[model samples]
Structure formats: C-alpha cells, structure tokens
Target: MAPIELKELKDQLQELLERGFIRLSVSPWGAQVLFVKKKDGSMRLCIDYRELNKITIRNCYPLPRIDDLFDQLQGAMHFFKIDLRSGYNQLRVKEQDISKTAFRTRYGHYEFLVMPFGLTNAPAEKLYAKFSMCEFWLSSVAFLGHIVSAEGITMDPAKVEAITKWPRMTSVTEVRSFLGLAGYYRRFVKVSHVWPYP
Candidate 1:
C-alpha cells in the first residue's frame, strides 16, 4: 500500500471504531484487511477470510438469473440503484460468533460487531430478506461479467481484450475460470457475431 493509502486506511479504521462497527479484539483468531481500488478510484476495504471460509459450510441457495431479472424490469419506466454503504456492516453478528470475524489492522486488532465480508453465507444470511433480483438499467452497467444497458446486453470490452491477449491455460482451475468468462459472452460471438445482442 502507498503512504496515502496507509493514511486513508488508518482514518477508515478510526471511523469504523467511532461508528461502533468494530471493537478492540482480544481474540486468538484474526484476519487481515485487503484494500482494492473501486471504479470511482476510491479505496475499498475488504477482509480476507479464506481460512475461515474454508471451514464453513455453504448455503445451497440459488441467486436469480440476470436475464430473468431483466425480463421482469422490461416495462418499468423509472430506474435508480439502491446504493448501500458498508452494506454488510449493517447486520449484527451473533455474540458468540463475533470472534470469528476479528481482524488485524496496522493500527490494532479489532473485531466486527456487525457482519464482516467473505463469509460464505454472509450475503444470504444478512441481505436475503431485502434482496430483489433486478437487472440494472444504466448507461453501462457490469452484470454477471458482461455489460448491460438500454442499448442492450454486451460483452465488456475489457473481457474481450483479456480473451484476445490471454495466455493458454495450463491448470484445470485456470481453464475453468477462463472458459467461465468466455461462456457468458459466447452468445455474442456464436449468435449475433456483433457487439451488442438484441
């Protein structure tokens, strides 16, 4: 992380404590925070919960399809995305399970009073009640690895560029990841042979 990023993260941690989202943790287990650049060029804080997730059982729930979601929104006139900030943090973790979400920052060790990210069933457990499966209507919205808008659904140009410049896959996991990306936009190449699908 850059010096600026380090400062921003410290400020973010202080804010999280002030906001009562986290508390000084004395837990034996701890996770590290991962920062990533968002689309708007702002730093987004995330926790790497790979070790914890490996031991947790997954919820066998199916998320609704993007195409099916769009089909429902076909005739709607008004469109605006419901933007929630620190969405996962809005939900409280069980008192006993709070220790599981404890994380370490450069500043200090802290545990989440609210739900933390990277839990296998976190989204389903927290946001499931308020969840609505609807396709986003925007100038250009990334939907399921593809871009969609009023002009119609299309492959994201970045993904196309990656596909063209991408190296040959050596491992099964790499092949699956590559094929999974191509599979979404395969309709564009095989059916329409064009940029946007009608």
Candidate 2:
C-alpha cells in the first residue's frame, strides 16, 4: 500500500470503530481487505468476501422485478429516487454471524457489527423503508438503466449506445452473452418478431 493509502485506511478504520460499525475481533475467520478507487480518487474500503460467500447460505428472498417497479410508477406524477448512503451499514449483523464478517487490516483485525456489502444473504429491501435520503424528480428519472416516467419507459441512451457498439459475436458464448444483455431491453425494440442469426 502507498503511504497515503495506508493512512487513509487507518483513518477509515478509526472512523468505523468510532461509529460502532466494527470492533476488534479475534475470530478464526478473516477475509481480505480491498481498496477501490472512488470516482473522486479516494480509496473506498471493500472486503473481498468470495470465500465467505461460498460458505454462506444464499438468501432466497425474491427481489422486486424492475418491470413491476415501473408499473407502480404509471399513475405517479412525482418520483423520488432513494439513495441509501452506507446502506449495508444500516443493517445489523446477527449476533452469531458477526464473527463470520471479520477481516484484517494492516492496523488490526476487526469484525462488522453491521452487515457489509458482498455478503450473499444481505437483503437490502428493508433498508429502503428506513430513510428519506433521495432526490425528487417531477416526471422522469433514470432507474435500473431505463429512463422512466408517466410517459413510459425508454432505454437509457448509454445503454443504447452500448448495444450499438457491442462487438460482433464470434463464439456461441459471446452470442449468448450479447443476447442476454440485449434481451433485458427488448421492450424498447419494435416488435418485428423473428430474429434469425445470420
């Protein structure tokens, strides 16, 4: 780690400790720490939880469908895009599960008191009901990669641009991957049904 990043990591750890989000741990489990560069060029601390996630039971909670969420917006004249800051931190780790979320930093080892991102079973739906931190829009808003409004949904321009510039598929796997991505926005395409791969 660079000296500056090491300092930032220590500062972040201290802040988390002060906020009661994490505590000193002597758990047998330890996951790796990751420092991701944020848009502002600051380090965003992340935990590499792949090994833990492999052992954790998957949460089978059904997430709301994007189509259904858009359906609910049909009659609404206003839209509020809720952005949860440190959303995962808002949920508590179960008493028995806290040790499982432990990770080591250069400073020391610590475990999360709150749920952290990258956990397989961390259901986020309940967090939406807890806060009003959001931006209000009069008619339309970009959501789940689509611009939605009372006027109806349209593919976000960026998504359309991606589809346009998608590399030509040379392999079966690539074709499947392209189809899977394009299929997500199939509603935006005019319905001339038959698609034969030429």
Q: State residue 161's C-alpha deviation in candidate 2, in Å.
A: 2.4
Model 2 pairs in collision = none
Best by lDDT: 2
Highest TM-score: give the candidate number. Answer: 2
Q: Write the per-residue lDDT of candidate 2 for residues 1-198, one digit (tens) a residue.
A: 888888999999999999999999999999998789985897888999999989877877787888898888787777777778788898998999999999988899999999998889787666743356577765888888888787788889998898899998889998888888788988877874758475
Backbone clashes, each candidate = 0, 0
Query: Over the full model, what C-alpha lDDT does candidate 2 score relative to the true structure?
Result: 0.86
RMSD of 2: 3.7
Regions more than 4 Å wrong, model 2: 1-8, 36-43, 123-133, 166-180, 191-198
- Candidate 1's displacement at residue 183, Å, is 4.1
In Å, residue 98's CA in model 1 sits off its true spot by 0.8
Query: After superposing candidate 1, which stretches have Cα over 4 Å from the reference?
Result: 65-80, 124-142, 145-152, 157-183, 191-198
lDDT of 1 by residue, 91-190 (tens): 8989999899988888899988998777878873334323363434445566566665666666878989998988977788887887777776666775
